[model samples]
Target: MTARVDSAPADSQAEAFKRLYPDQYYRRFLSQNTRPDGRSLTQTRPASVVLGVITSADSSALIKIGNTTVIAGVKLEVLMPKDPPDQGCLQVNVELTTLCSPEMRDNRPTEVPSFLTQQVDAAVRGSSAWQPQALCIQAGRAAWAVYLDLYVLCADGVLLDACVLAAMAALNALRLAPVDVTDAGNVVAAGNDAMTDGTSHPQQPYALSKQGTPLTLTCAVIDDRLIADPSSEEESLAATVVSTTVDGQGHVMGLQHAGGGVELSTAHLQQCITAAQDRHTDLFRVLSSAQPPDH
Candidate 1:
């Protein structure tokens, strides 16, 4: 009983030390096969997704993984591409503001936003989540351009994963509004008397192709150990980071690797794919639940 009472003070002192030296604290936790946040190396924090957060946009989704939060919104515009007027365009942008993290408090640009935009764009377009040709109003005339915008509300860790998820969910929840294509190659709202010269098209909701939904999961290589769904703190100390995008059919869509000095082995890459597939199962469950019944 006496020894236990004395240990309480020692534990309190250790806690204080951890707060004072976070890097060392995290190392100590990793040495014991755990993280400072009480998660194992391969485990991720609580995640959730909600659709239709922004009423102004055609479709939107808000996703959260632990303290990190991201929201995605889509807007449709009429684009007349020179080469493939039959195929619509996909514009992806990622915005980071002071509201996301202290690093952005100065209002300077960082590489993170562009990197995130590339990852999300590749995952959605490369995976063919929705066929661009389907957006065509008339051959060689006009097509719908999808504007996918992602905003980071918080950046605790695994930001790319959250952003990709939000983008995919928002695109998945998107429903194309009925429009009329005028002879002058202009698109206007359907059933509007102002655009009487245009031909009205039947309302068709946007839907994902037969291809399964895409999900991107991020992993960090820390001290030569692979950890999936790393928190922002862990990502900071990582030697390398890899992101794997997979579909519900367990198909690999895209892979992104950042940072170097430590080369990842083939086995590690395979593990990342496996981890993404398993995580995809869980993510899809959340996405399916968030989808509207009409879709």
Candidate 2:
């Protein structure tokens, strides 16, 4: 008589191998001071920004970091403020489409996207990047509400960093159109005649300051090696992930850490901050080159 046996499925076997031997698998590449993608420790992926991709939006930018791509659009709306409304309001929304990756679902708001939206909002608010008063048409009566919408076309990891950069670029490219209040107290777009009239508000268009914009840098810690801008595969193997936002003046605007694999020391944290500061110039150069010239 012959005995019948069942073996583990290929998918299950592969998953088990990764779960059991991830450290060892990653260590093989770390020993050579390289990553699976052939990038050295502390090396970041290539980044690029394109401005004015969406003509309908007041401002728009498309940013790509490695294979991850994020598009941000800014739209300005006039709103009547409630009591104690002294400053303009900023609203941010992030969408992670299933087309970007298999892990995401269609038309569903996932945890990652929600978390990224909050982080981008905090980064903007914490840095005081936009002067709310500048957006005010009339204190407590009327103000501009800025809506920033971010869409992830591809997610290869380092999502927060890409989103923040795209948002900053879009805001930098924004140009506010002149607005006028009618006799009936309704806000309307200033026509050519109104633009020439001295009675119209003499507000000049302005853009966000590049210096106040903050850039986020994400690092993945694997087997005691810190890798900058980790890929999706590397992120899966990471023991700790740290994201730090730095302004152009080298000030640390925000810091966040996730994962339970490793505890980072103060020195290690400082090292990450320094690395982020060092890369600020390169990112700023990309943003500057993509901005539209002022008319």
Any runs in candidate 1 off by more than 4 Å, and if so which? 1-12, 192-201, 208-210, 293-295
- Look at candidate 2 and tell me the lDDT of residue 200: 44
TM-score on alpha carbons, each prediction: 0.88, 0.86
Worst 10 residues of 1 by lDDT: 192-201
Residue 69 lDDT in candidate 1: 95
State model 2's lDDT: 0.84
- List the candidate 2 regions with Cα displacement exceeding 4 Å: 1-23, 106-109, 192-200, 293-295
RMSD of each: 4.2, 4.5
Question: Model 1, residue 284: displacement in angstroms?
Answer: 1.0
Per-residue CA lDDT of model 1 for 200-251, tens digit only, reads 4555554645367788889999888899899887898899999998998899
The sequence of per-residue lDDT tens digits that candidate 2 reaches over residues 72-184 is 99998988767557677889999887788877755555688889999999988877566776677666677889999999999999999999999899888887767776666
- Cα lDDT computed for each candidate against the true fold: 0.84, 0.84
What value does the lDDT take at residue 151 in candidate 1?
94
